[model samples]
Target: MKRALEKLGCAPVLEAADGIAAQEVLCRHADVALVLTDITMPRMDGLELLRWGREAVPGAVWIVLSGVETFDSAVAAIRLGAFDFLPKSPHSEELAVAVRNALERRQLLAERERLYLELQRKVHELEQTSEALRRDLQRAEVIQRALLPHSPPPMEGYCIQAVYRPGQHVGGDLYDVVRLGERHLAFYLADATGHGVTSAMLSVLFKQRLVLVDATSGLPLSPAAVLDAVNRSICEAHAAPGLFLTAVFGLLDTSNASLTVASAGHPPVLHLRAGRETRLVRRTGPALGLAHDAQYHEEHLQIAAGDRILLYTDGLVPSGTERDLHRLQQVLAEQRSSVQDILAQLHDAAQGAERDDVTVLLLDAHAGASWFDNGAEGRAAAASRAPRTEQDVVFYGEADEAAWLALRGRATWMQSDVFHETGQAVLAAQRPLVLDLSACEFMDSTCLGTVHELVARGGVTLVGVAPGVHALFEELSMGDVLATVRRDAPAAPELYAIGAGSSQAAVQQRILQAHEALSSLSTRNREEFRDVVESLRGDQQAGGGHG
Candidate 1:
């Protein structure tokens, strides 16, 4: 039998005298693929060997053979997990077919086992990766929460409230209420273009770059100017197509309850008065980062006692319909209780599953505040205490020596005369000009352009530059020039005054020169100020002045 099997290409077949011997041989040769055995054996029967071998070599295939084949014996052998049972001394062709079929079965079982183990390994690896991603998202959500305000700053006779709810682990809505100097309170709400980590990152950049106070001036910027500056910055550095933000910024003068608001493609702000009609502060410009030269217009309103202003993201009204907005307005108008209660009512009113981030900021004026009445008498009282405008420009040191030019108060187009006269005088003397902006509260685009012109002429240094101003310069692509400038302490000496009072033609000339200088700084500046420069030139020619 062994010779026959070897002749059929089954090599190195081990022979055993009985089932017991077969067990011993099988134990020693664990790598055996197929087992051919007889139904009757000496020490142990084939059925017993088959059962024992099944456990020892689970992957091996078994076939039974007997000299006197019986139906009962064949059934017993087959029940014990044998692949085939045949009479002993069978045809050579039948023996070959049985052995071949059994070996093929063995190969299939081995492959099945391999694939099962591999599937388990891959599933385990996927589970580990999923767990790590979950942990990372948790950390990111914590950091995003930290960027939000824990509590609003205290203001007399006013109540400020904010609520933020992200639909996912992290969201794209951001809001901040910052106190600018002593009198102005600035607040804004921004919503990025999309959801998830990318949008969250964009919102963070907006928060970092939003300049509430002017760097050159120590005072707060107007709402429109604040939005315009932020838009210009986003357009210059981070403008990706289809990526923009909707925002509304407001500046509140606490002394007289005057609120100036500006919006960029944002939902209208709801103004709820105590007993009058609810008003909407609507958008004045396109969304941020859409256009470099987009202009924002300001809307000024008086906040009376017991009035409330609600600023929210579109998530608060996902439907974005007139009925939904009216419902929100009705809720704000009816809910005269605490801001928290109003927010809860608003949330309850929101229908369907939340698909976006929801953010709401509420400003409430307390009842019976005498200062809330923004009448002419109140304005007169506030004006009486307002600081008088000081000399904006003063020059120190003689023309021959290195000179210092100080800018105080608000520097705008009105100060172009002083800037032109002093700048020309310093250039004629061939002296290095050091500009002092320590006491300056604000600088308009015209003034910034004039400063740019002086820098272009060479030998110019800017000192006491505030962080906001530095960011502005960098956004306008003036960082290379500013990088070489040095900071130095101003010297106290005789001050020479240059009045801003000048002819219309001279003022037009200064505006043109300043814008032209700014336009030369960057391509974006050139595109932005091109119209203003051309318009001024046209005006100059019409007035018979040199263009």
Candidate 2:
């Protein structure tokens, strides 16, 4: 039967040929487009041959030759990704058309493969670039972390807990507890204007200048003075375009009982007392880097034991509307119910997720407890001496010899820095050190405020204060400018009556209630009553008590 077909010029069908041989021939020869094979084979069948040929040969076409015209065979050929199936009695033109169509389809598919490979190559290149950029960003983050202080500086009589989170990989928020000397603890939290790494750069710039001012001025610069000087320097440095800083700078005297704070365009600082009440402190100056003379307010906070001072950037408020911000303050207050409670609140607030660059600094005014922060042992020592406020020092822009001499004469106890190691050395000596201002001319209000805080918080006395520094003091008053100054500085020259000014009459009444509560308390609840009284007194005095 096969010979008869062969005599009619038909090729002898090798029905038992294995799929491997069929595949090899299809791949090896460029001209072999049509696949002619029997359904049943020794090793592999005709359907397997068709599928293999279709994949291996870019433009290969398949035609199955079957002895039986069964539906199952036809279905199997299609299932194997095979081309057209033919019976033994198929017409010539039909065969020709099927073969032509398959060849055309394979050609179209070959072009598609080429385009896909090209697309894959481009995609790989894009992925490589993205990876490189990610690496670069990671490197930048490392450098930024290196620049920040490893641990919060130590103070003699205070416990400070601060949580700083950058909104992005690098944020503009900057906080550092600088030890100007043994007695002075200078800590500042600064938030640059706007967002992104540009703001962070400004923060970096402010820190560098702050350190520079401490070194060169040789003065016991207060928090206000530092803010003023830093603000001016930043303004001058970035005055070219739009740049500013909303910041808070504090100078604490752990040995004494005063905290001097200065604010520049930051949010109103909160003073949380034990009475389950909170007060907003509006200090002045201006944000750093705004303008050369942008004013900042300074306030004194008297602290004893069991009191807290909360310092934060504006991200906590989300715009001061409603009580969202105040709620955060309340949360802070209740958390102090215990350490465990505080930790829980902190964990929830910052489960490593920050809405913005939310930063919080809590100063435990009650000097008994010690704080382990940022790898540093933070302690605030309570001086067993009388209170003292800011002394006098001339503002210097550039270094000068004559001004330096005047500062030396004016201030017996000079302070430079107390938060960092170098600042610690400059400020620690118990002597009435004279600060050098020969290299400084322009001064920032934060430095002035810091000096004030030291005087109020520590036992250092504020003597021979220059009138020039007074203007900055008056400008940052929330109300009762004189009252604020006096209360902030324990070493104030003269004491004023509690209700001296008519403007503060109501304020004095409330204040008297608090003070009387403290002064008239009996021995039984002295500690408990004293805590509330001291806190209330501090709140009312905003000007008198030193930390």
Candidate 3:
């Protein structure tokens, strides 16, 4: 670089005596621009000197000095990376010009080197960023896949299909088809508060809670129970605040030709029967988390052979479409075709473009009573088929709170009660609990206070809930204290009909159990159905304020 600078009209070159002396001079002034050497010298010839310069001083601009033609020698120097070659007996002006040209070439080479280094640095930086994004995407894919059912149970008489489309790196929509032994299946579609990681996270928590119901509950949990628990969890704990889920939890009873469903502040569901007859089931509960005591109700509808019950999220309801009751009637009346036909027609009616996340789960029940062995042996085989990453216990309804508290007094579990019986069950719970409100249509401060008391006592995990009631808790500031509850059951029943065994005595026992469950429901012990209604009204008022 210095040699090039001197040739740009800066300095002079020092001449040396012999080849050895020249070598020493070259070493001493390594940064010098020009290497002017004579082809014939005392100890070293110009060609030999040129070779030494090529080995030792590669960066310098060289000018060969030879009395002979030196053309071949010059070519050799050039090949050795010399910038330019000159004759020894050249005119003074020519010699000076040659030196200047050599330095000029050196300067150009130096500039090119700088540009190359800068480009390499940029390319390396871009590679690192790309690698980081790749890692993030892989992680996202893993998380999204985990949210889906590993393998939904094969529902007798029905084939199931589930599709997920994530707009960004993650999605907040989810669906599940769980097989609850006895040839029964439970299906649900839920959407979280919003898009992106946080929304996706909340939804995931909700899903885990649904599948992770406390094995200690000692009772076969129903769909209404699941929704109520989910609601209570969100209303009380780690669930979204301004956010809530619009979802449906349904049961497909293959043998009975019936479908039972409970809605949590979601779009109305459409039912397509065998005669091309259609009916729309409207949502009965506030959106999950809206009210601390929002109570979700389940409706049982009978279906003939070939009846198709279509359940979907609000994305197809077309926000404005569901605001009016008429839209539901329209959906039912126009179901002139099959389940697929109704789903498409509903989407078209929903104004597809304003679309939110759309999801549809269809249940088909064909002719005559289709009964599988569903015997103890088949149940045992299914149970032992594979080892689950997560394991949970099943509780019968007859179980008392002591059994539940003993099993999970310390672990986080959300407490929820949507049905009139559930509140009594909560009272029966001895452990501190996280409450769920996904199924409750009502709840008040009294219910909220009890929930708080439970939180103060033991560990809790809350999930699924609505916004209005969520705000109330925010107002009272109890929202942060609730952790969250999750359910892990594969199949949950929505509508429960407790019929006696055979004898009149058995019938009496069934009636007695129902009465006991209902009688036990009281604010003095546990908040009852009244508390749920009250909670819901308060939530509506709170929501109205925001609207």
Candidate 4:
């Protein structure tokens, strides 16, 4: 029968002695798409083989041959997923037609399976591509956020508020406030030409090129010169066609209470005076990166007490709105409560519909008290009545070239004030300052603030810090900021041990509170001591019962 089937157009036909051998042949050759077996055979019958083949290879077609033309056997074979059942004495024409139909059905199913696998492969590739793009956008947003200042740099006698919000994942708007000299502060807000990666990259490049000093003059550049230099830089360095930026730069002379501003086709800024009156400050200059050697003019305004200056980009205004200057003036006039309150109102007005980056800077001339002013005469008057203790003596001595400031006992709020007063001279002196903390056993948050003040002034080194004292610095994440050298022996063994008449729990509680204050320095510091901070906090809440 196999030879006959081959002669009838089945090439390379396989022959099996019984149903078991036929099943074995199907297992060995995966390409065998068709199976023919007799109904009654040795070792595993055709009916069993049909069941196995249907489950093992559903894509293969099966045909059964029987000498006895019993309706029961034919029905049984058909129920086992047999494609066809033929009598043993069937004609060649019938066999050829059955084989032809079975082969055609098998080919169609195989083609469908191949197409389904290809579709699955394409879907997996698309998912991976989408994940990569999402990660890239997330990283871009982080880079852009890091470029902004975490906090305003220390500026004396001025109150500045800056607000920045991006419409999309990233934007092309940026503002920078730089201290150009001892009494001069230069601030600029720039909006690049486009959005997303291209514009963000340009903004970063512009910031790098826009230095505080002019390359030609070497001195701190004026507001007009800074803008002119930036204009030339954009034109020379950036070759991208049609690339340009609109910016406004302001140089503030805090000493004279005056401001000089220059513009490069940016929006007009609003100035609010003491009597609830608003005036527009404007300067006409070509937008940057458009023309080489673009000239700019500076407008000087004498800032008065209780006066406010508003700066913003065009994105603050919704598109299709009237360009009437009165609308903007009214918005700034009505929202005069606080810087944060004004920004809140503007954000509410936008209602998540902003199409571009929004940046607003408000500088209020409050003539506020100076940061360094602590009313030394009043403190001196009070100090004369109260007996001075050795604990309050923060100033130690003046060494060869470096002045030494040591903390003998508890460095709390009083010690902090003493350091601020006596240490001010050390900070101003030409010699280096060395902070000796060997005898210092404890410090509160106020003392840490004084430490930060000294470090900010520069040329201050810490020496002889023990583990208990050093824990406070490490907890505040100031370990890297202050240079400290530990002594061979613990600075103060009494700090770590129970006092002669005091309880150990009381001492530990004080140490824990100081560490808690240190942990409150920043969010990252809190995370670094999460476990220890939580455990110590739980112990404190339990009345120092836990060790």
Give the number of the best model, judged by TM-score.
Answer: 1
Model 3 lDDT per residue over 1-547, tens place: 3354356566764767878888998898888667877666788877777788877877777777655566787778678666666565666577667766877888988889999999999998787567555535433533454445544465555655544444344656788777766746778888877766766777777776675234796333667888898888877775435877778888767678567888887766767666665777778688887787888889888877666666666555545453444554455445344434545566545553334555556555643222211012222343446453221211111111111111111111111111212322434333222344444444444445544544444454444445655664555546444334445312221211111112233222323333233324443323433454445445546666222
lDDT of each: 0.76, 0.54, 0.55, 0.68
Better of 2 and 4 by TM-score: 4
> Residue by residue across 1-547, what tens digits does model 1's lDDT show?
7877999999889989999999999999988888888878888988889889999988788988876646588788788789997787778888999998989888887889899999999998787567545544533554565566544666777878776766665788998888777788888999998887878888888888788877797789898998999899888877578888999998999999999999999999999888999999889899998999999998998999989999989888767788878978887877555444555675546645655777888888873221111011222343346554465354333221345676776778877755756665666546567787766777777888888877777888777777766676777787655764556655533334433555456677888888887888889999998999999888888878943
Clashes of 1: 3
Taking all chains together, the TM-score of candidate 2 against the true structure is 0.50
Task: Order the candidate numbers by TM-score, best to worst.
Answer: 1, 4, 2, 3
Q: In model 4, which regions exceed 4 Å deviation? A: 1-10, 36-47, 62-129, 215-218, 281-283, 293-298, 323-328, 348-355, 367-547
Superposing all C-alpha atoms, what RMSD in Å does each candidate have to the true structure? Answer: 24.1, 27.6, 22.5, 18.4
Question: Measured by TM-score, how close is model 1 to the native structure?
Answer: 0.62
TM-score, model 3 to reference: 0.41
Candidate 4 residue lDDT tens string, 1-547 = 8777888777788888887788778888767778887888889888888888888777789888877656577778888788898888679889889998999988887888999999999997787567545545533554565466545656766777777766565778888777766888888888887777777878887788887786675667888888888888878896778777889998888889899888898888778876856767675598888899789998888888877888887777645244545666666666445544555565546656545776778777873421211112222343446665554535344332454667767777544533543355556534466777877888776577567666757777777775787887776777544454534422321111101111345444544544455566689756765776577668767874643
Worst 10 residues of 1 by lDDT: 369-378
Clash count list over all predictions: 3, 106, 57, 0
